[model samples]
Target chain A: MQDREKAFIRALVRSNATFGIGDDGVEISNFVVANDAFFEDVHFKRAWGSLESIVEKCFVVNLSDIYAMNAIPRFCLLMLTLPTDFKEVGKLAKIIGNCALKHKVKIIGGDTIAGDKLHFSLTFLGQRQKSRILTRQSIKKGDILGYMNPSSVLTHTKTQAFGKNTKILKTALRFHQHRKIQSNTRFAKPILYPKMLLELNSIARAGMDISDGIFMELPRLSHLNRLGFKVFKPKGDWLYAPEEYQMLYAIPKNKLKKMQNFAKKHRHSFVPFAKAVRGKYRESKKNWHT
Target chain B: MQDREKAFIRALVRSNATFGIGDDGVEISNFVVANDAFFEDVHFKRAWGSLESIVEKCFVVNLSDIYAMNAIPRFCLLMLTLPTDFKEVGKLAKIIGNCALKHKVKIIGGDTIAGDKLHFSLTFLGQRQKSRILTRQSIKKGDILGYMNPSSVLTHTKTQAFGKNTKILKTALRFHQHRKIQSNTRFAKPILYPKMLLELNSIARAGMDISDGIFMELPRLSHLNRLGFKVFKPKGDWLYAPEEYQMLYAIPKNKLKKMQNFAKKHRHSFVPFAKAVRGKYRESKKNWHT
Candidate 1:
């Protein structure tokens, strides 16, 4: 780093403000709750992404986990790795605070480190009702798989970052500009729907958000119970490309209809994708997504 | 990535194992963690610093955080960027796991990504006591500053990479290598002292372990509480030299003498750094590692 940059960083460190860039790492507490997001470049970018959208995107990424577990996020630890002279630190922080307020989450303890690329990882601690908790390993075979939020966040980014150096900022801007020109923007609504997950009660059987390659997540969850899954994902391009934060739940076949009703009540897209099976992938049909 | 390397990645992914590296990115869960480390080339050369020591060094650097937070760390996430695969990753992972088990921690999650230089990071998480949380913001002025482990983790890695690199592997078998090395090896012990923290119950006003620079952290904790810190960090290079981990707490002055009793019980060190001040840097203290 040049002398000037070093000086800038030192000032950021000495700002005596909430958070800043520092060579000396964070002064954190113990028995703490934190979460970090290792965002793929296209998942968040600044160029055209409105500061609010970028901020909103970050909240969506993390709260997805909180929702999947049917928990209420109490505090968040935001760890950011961005380029020197990070263009939007202050704005992003503000947006995060606002979103947290909307969701009743607090920005308690976290750090911001400098990296060559933009990787925003936020660790959040949620308050679960002890026994009312859910985990991937607890999933059972033959449980009906009830999926929600048909237009997952994955579909959004895949469309925006189909090629080139796609990043969070560019993808966000793509949505923003599209909304501005069309004079209609429903992005925020879908993004906020995950917050309703806390009300899922006990219906969300073995559950997980469609992060990573959803294709990969399915078989992995099934394996936890030595079972296979027969998924009937929507037969469209949307099934393949997604930024959609789709919730994959393993409810029993008898409860699938009830779960769909719950989704309609909350107005989330409830799409039944697969059924938990009792065989290996080789023995089952593999023609889906192909 | 060539075809074979791509296949290697595919197989790692197909295993449905956590922490695989691919286009889909790392897939470790919340129970998993990884951290990053950026070091000066002169900081540790391959000649004097055995690959085992480097591996141990990286583990201490991050494992310290896991212990500091009073979390039961189950795994370690590693990403080391070096000129070549000069170090055996399996050996590194095993050594880290051994260290974790010694400390009652675990090595359940990790992701390794190559980089242009010898920069590495680990993002790991541990289970913290859900309650009895600690944070830097809780420190008020006039609190006692205590040192759990006053030592530093400094070693010579200067002649290694520049000289007969990794020649230690070819040297006549060293007899001492078989001895059970101390977990408190000067370079590793400073960071692994979780026992001291377990003693810090309800008394600590504000605290954070010194990893960056203790002097740097004093001001940080001060800033976090919107207060000023008065610290007597020794008067020389000790302030800037990289420290593995050292406790820096501001407890109530009334508890100052209690630390001595605690010290006797634990054989720990107690350093009476300056009082928690209410203003900016003192004019007389310009040697603040600035």
Candidate 2:
């Protein structure tokens, strides 16, 4: 987050003394509520993907927040701002409806309006699972920090492809046989292991989804837990790739082998790249939000 | 709602077989979930009111939905889009925080991002009161349709004032002593009688907030209840005025005396302008959404 945004949120947290603002979602009675905004140009370019893919990505990202809290998404409220010239309203609605059906979430209520840009803000209400809600504030000093990296080359290439020119992807999608790229891009279909994350809830001391990359999230974990991270030779994209949607977790040092076994059974490469240490940690100012 | 928007929502309703999409808010368990968007220019022009008042109106409008459903708003998630050059971040946070505090609503979780225009999408979760939840589908034939019109000339003037050029209001607010206008306008501070509405829940067979005017909302009630409205000599603005934030209710015809007595005790004029009849009702295409 930028400095101004941080200051604004700080003011809000200070003013609302009882606000639990640090978690992915707030727990109220047995329900976890979360919201996220996916605006055109800011979150995605129209030329980069189809509307179906864009809508799917919006759902995936918001649902990730719910899963990170160890809750099952049960209902959603969508606020859509459609452009004036935008047609194909039926297609848009079907995509959303189908997404909700596939996820077993009820389409409760929301508002739709016409505007100059296409913007979507989704609010999801999730029910807690059998285990306790996982949060970023429960890490211990001896916890081992690891992430469930789904072993897929297509996913890696898709994340890398986002930094390239959108014009090339647009042209390729229009003319070339790029069905694989169209279907496999992370922006269109983000990889999320909900079952794995939910099962790991028993062992995860602290956890959150990697939306703004691990480098950006580590400091938050550090600040919340009052400890620094001792890196185990962290490399390249693992540190700075935003919107990974992977689960970053702090596990008990003794439960590392059990967590690894669970991850291995799920075809996920569990990378324990850091350990919680007793020190202050500071991070670079760069982030997905500008 | 416009034809396209209607069609879009119809498609959504059809696709999601179990969706309960007609009410002002959706009831899940004991909570009512509602969402609304207050986009810049679309909902209100910045030149028309102060940022603090603008923010306050946003809260009132969303909370009105909760109250109309016979529930008390307990939590909210805000999705804010801040313009690039926008300042006064601290002031905005304080206003939001204070509004949440005033309504006894917790600021649970939300997302904030920088964009080209100021937009806010608020999702409110309200806890149901002792009375059963009021919805639009329960109005029966011969039920009296009434609205709680707070006896205030300033509110009427404010609704009419929106029709005039905004430049006049802008210039007046800038140079003249318009403190009254600054704080009293419906756009700045909408009038909502939550206590009165909640108390009347026992008698209201059906109810909803008059968001897009009585004319626009009548058809919705008509369609939902499978009955037509017998409007009794509807006057000018009462038919077409939007964003009144007043509760439009369906009361049993025999309970008119009790409803009137309740309104009189609360110092509100309960205007019974219509009755439910057996037929069809159609509305003009013009609405706030366009």
Candidate 3:
């Protein structure tokens, strides 16, 4: 989180109104409500891709939160702001409706208005897992932190396409000229593993979708779990690459073998890079989200 | 609704994903979920009021939907976008938290980001009434359409405060100079009647919050109920005034006396201005909402 957002949320924490403010999505009885905003120039630009692809990424980002919690998304409400002269209103509605139908989520209701920039704020209602809801607070002091990454071939291609440790803004600008951005590029149709997340629900102690990169999410998990992390050097550009939409999980020492086996069978890499310890841990670098 | 929005929603009506798109809020089992977007230059301007008052209006507008459905609001999730250089982040959070607390709504999780303009998209989860859920589709032919208005004193003052049928944009600019807009002014802390709405829940057959003025809303009711309205010539500036946040209800002819008595007891005027008929009714004026 950005410092300003963190400070703002700290003040909100003082009020009784804040009940489930720190999780991926707040659990309300059998449902989980998650919301995310995608604003023009801040999150994406029209030059980056087609409107269909842009809309798809917005839906995928919100769906990641639901799947990370082992929940099935059921309903969707969209608050869309379009430029006054922007045509293709019907196409926008078609894309949104088709995406909801593809996910089996009902488009219940929302409000749309005209504005200077395009903005979409989507609220997703997901049916919670019947037995348990995975959250970030359940990690233990000795839990091992692992993250789901794409296959080795895709990772190698991504590394070559964007170069190691290159900021996303530069890559997005470079790829925009080609007009053929590979799906492996960050923020281009993020890959989510729902089935693996469901399997890990029985083994992992806690988990969340990594949108703000591992460098930023680790401190949040550390604060929530009241434990520090014994960090290990990551092999590639995965540490600070934002918008992965992949799951970061904390697995107990005993269930480590089972989790590894599940990831291997699913053909996904689960790279363990940290272990929870006694002291606090903070990222030295500033957040790129702001 | 604007012409573009009407066309956009008409296309969405084709998909099975759209279940309850024509109501104040979508009823999902026991909960009613409503979402609305407030954007700078579109909904409100920073120069029009203090930040606290602007934020309060955002919450009140969403709450109006919940009360219009006769549901009790339970939770709120906010997607807020602030300018990069804007300060007072903590103050914004406090006002939001306090507003939720005052309304007895829990502040759940949401997303916040920095952008070029201020934007807020609020989602409210409300518990549906146990006995029934009020909707716009239940109005029957021969039903008398009534609206809840402020008492005579406030109405008279409001009539003189902003001249009858004056455009809101010009009035807002003129009022912005004085910096002392009355609470009765449109979009300036709208007055809601929850107790009276609950009382009318049993007497009125259909109801909805009038956000896009009575002229625009009446056609929506006509389209939903497949009946026309014999609209009375309104006495004052009420018909074309947008952002009133008042309730427009459809009551049976036999229950008009009971509804009036209840409104009198509550010190609100129930103005019966229309009756459902077989012929269609269309407002000639273009929608001011766009």
Candidate 4:
């Protein structure tokens, strides 16, 4: 069913589509329309966070699509289906409103209904100058493939927080026991760099926000452009790790230095992980799990 | 939780909002954004009809919101969350695509995910010329209230085909057994008259598509305008019956005749059921049940 779903959606892509089903969002005219669905068990368990964190994450995940296209998000429509037995509807709305306010995205409209499980669908409307919009179709062979590496907070929080002293190790054991709470507080949120990306949009040919891991998205980018990728640092299982809201981009090799300087100026980091190659969707000779 | 949800949404309605949470959709900058959710057991069952009919109904219901505002639908973003075990994904996509093609509305983007239950959310983007937009805020006290009556096919199909005679009654039972099949085929479809409504947009002040029965919508329209309604013919239970795709409007008393003529010319029917009155939010003095 999943394979059939992909094939069906691919068949519906139209010529006017700037980004189709496989990409982060779809662009038409000057606007980008994207919707993301987060289910209870699929995306998060109740024990993972508070209702506020869950609501905030929903906004972040949906807005990430607009940011991936280097577009300025303007408005959002949130549709929430809640279980009949659930409470705290007001808290969820308050958190969502706060998130929207912080991001300057207006909550224009939505629908709320009672269902068997908790589900949220947020549709984001964003705009970008036509020439500045990024898509997966414009990648050329030899363009540098780069990724916004997971932020230090996300990476450090996922590892043990303390080093190897016996006394500290005993205390770290207690802290590690509370790691789930700490991790949810810091790393469950989406990282957005819309303004920075918009400033650098001209330097990149095509890009996508990584939600379904780098391995899955690389083939999609390659399939769309009739090209292949060669990863240089393919020595870890990070290729399959879910990076959620990180982004992958195809940059011209000549502009890599400029982008690096701009990233430094903005205090952002872009790691060059792969390079586009002329072939039929083949990966590098290096194994993904070396 | 339901009450809290309503209160929370009402609190978020901004000053510039033409219609907010309680209305059919929201209007901003000449475009109306609306989203509707249809769930498996709550909206339809597998025994109700074919998958094609279900998919078609989804488009019709979403498009009706644009028609209610006398706007031209431009684009749609669909979000479907289907059970992992479900098949027939391709057929669902095909029907949705055909419906969009027929309506001249572009299916720009969408998301499909796996969920525990079957759910579909459609966000419609529609536009109206600034002068042609209809909103609840413009309704006047003395305006005439009108509705697009449910078509004969939707009405008569609800009653027994045979009125009198034992011979006919025996055959009617067998025919009635098949009525569910027929009703699902014809009445379950959404009826849209966007072009005609756009032509008549000037005559209407405030309007909304009737999805949650006329009785329910009447109170909402009245509450929004701080006025009341007086129904002339209040003895029928049609007020409570779910007329999924009909429209209700507030027209000026003087323009009622012109609207009637226009409806005739367009092969549409406008039934004037009530009048806007200066009072608190109350229904007609006439009883709803005879």
Q: Which runs in model 1 stand beyond 4 Å of their true positions?
A: A1-36, A40-42, A137-141, A149-190, A199-201, A231-235, A282-290, B1-96, B106-191, B200-207, B220-234, B237-244, B249-269, B273-280, B283-290
List where candidate 3 sits over 4 angstroms from the true fold: A152-169, A173-180, A184-186, A233-236, B152-170, B173-180, B183-186, B233-236
How large is the i-RMS for each model, in angstroms? 19.8, 1.5, 1.4, 5.5
Q: Please tell me which predicted candidate would have the highest TM-score against the true structure.
A: 3
> Residue A46 in candidate 1 has what lDDT?
47
Q: Per-residue lDDT tens digits of candidate 1, residues A1-290?
A: 12222232233223222121110111122112224344433343344345566666677756776666666565554445545555554545455556777777655433344556555555555666544555564556677665565333433332322111123323455564344221112232225455456655477666766544355455556555677777676544334433445566777678777777887677555667677778754222222110
| Model 4 chain B worst lDDT run, 10 consecutive residues | B160-169
TM-score of chain A, every prediction, order shown: 0.67, 0.89, 0.91, 0.81
Write down the RMSD of candidate 1 (Cα, Å): 13.9
lDDT of each: 0.47, 0.79, 0.79, 0.67
True contacts kept of each: 0.00, 0.72, 0.80, 0.36
Task: Give the candidate order by descending lDDT.
Answer: 2, 3, 4, 1
- The residue pairs found clashing in candidate 4 are none
lDDT of 1 by residue, B160-184 (tens): 1111112332231232334333333
Alpha-carbon shift of residue A200 in model 3 (angstroms): 1.9
Instruction: Give TM per candidate.
Output: 0.63, 0.91, 0.93, 0.85
How does candidate 2 fare on TM-score?
0.91
| Docking level of model 1 | incorrect
Task: Name the 10 consecutive residues with the lowest summed lDDT in model 3 chain B.
Answer: B156-165
* Top model number, lDDT: 2
